[model samples]
Target: MCGLSADKIQVATGHVEISTITNHYIKTSSTYQKQLLELGNMDSINSLEVNKLKEIIMLQNQEILRLKERLNLENEEQTKNANLNGSKNEFKGVVA
Candidate 1:
């Protein structure tokens, strides 16, 4: 029952793969077979390629977060400096 439930959830997740669809019709040497051939096979990319791509994405995300923190700190400092310079100056002989 657990296996059947798992299959149901798997199917519901919409993981219908291209290979599953391809095999369904390719036995007839259908036009789709030629199309798939032109598009190349999905079996080409290995686990290492996927892992490298994921690592690059993770690195980019970390860099973005670091930059955002730096910008926030700079903005806070600018606001503090602006407040310090924005106050009224002391009255001199020009006072009426």
Candidate 2:
């Protein structure tokens, strides 16, 4: 019975009617059932892998944003120091 309703079996097997499945396609093989279970397991494994990759990508993006902000702050500080040094040199030149 595969623990499934006749209508569900018919839909999955693409049979026109429940009677067709019960009459002609009712084979109870252990190997076939094992293969089906293995296929289901593969789907779950693939889903977990996909979720892990997405998490890694999100973390990387956050790190990139933090580094960019740090670079901008450093650049601004350098510009301010350069302006201050230029004014000091100009004042010394005028005095001498």
Candidate 3:
């Protein structure tokens, strides 16, 4: 019973963490978009700054995608684990 409760708590925490990450991603994305827009309008913007910003944005996007994929995989694995626990002791049986 406690294990189930703990699992629930862990899942809830993951969801909350993901939500926080998403909000942060949205905020950062908007800020970067504004920066990109400014780059288009400003003739004095440094090329080095533009390149750095582009690098950071690329890295951030990759990190966000990786986190999202991990979250989804965790959710899928947990759900599958729960479904396989009933009336069986063996794990990871072939899915039909």
Best by lDDT: 2
lDDT of 3 by residue, 5-73 (tens): 434544655645544544543344778879888878776557777788999999999999999999999
Q: What global local distance difference test value does model 3 have? A: 0.69
**Model 1: how far is 89 from its true place, Å?**
4.1
The weakest ten consecutive residues by lDDT in model 2 span: 22-31
Predicted structure 3, TM vs. truth: 0.43
The regions of model 3 sitting more than 4 angstroms off are 1-45, 87-96
Q: Rank the candidates by lDDT, best first.
A: 2, 3, 1
1-96, model 2: which lDDT tens digit per residue?
477777878888899976688666665467877878876778777878889999999999999999999999999999999999999999999999
Instruction: Identify the superior model by lDDT, candidate 1 or candidate 2.
Output: 2
Which window of ten consecutive residues has the lowest lDDT sum in model 1? 87-96
lDDT of each: 0.64, 0.85, 0.69
Best-to-worst order by TM-score is: 2, 1, 3
Q: Which pairs in model 3 have colliding backbones? A: none
Point to the candidate with the largest TM-score. Answer: 2
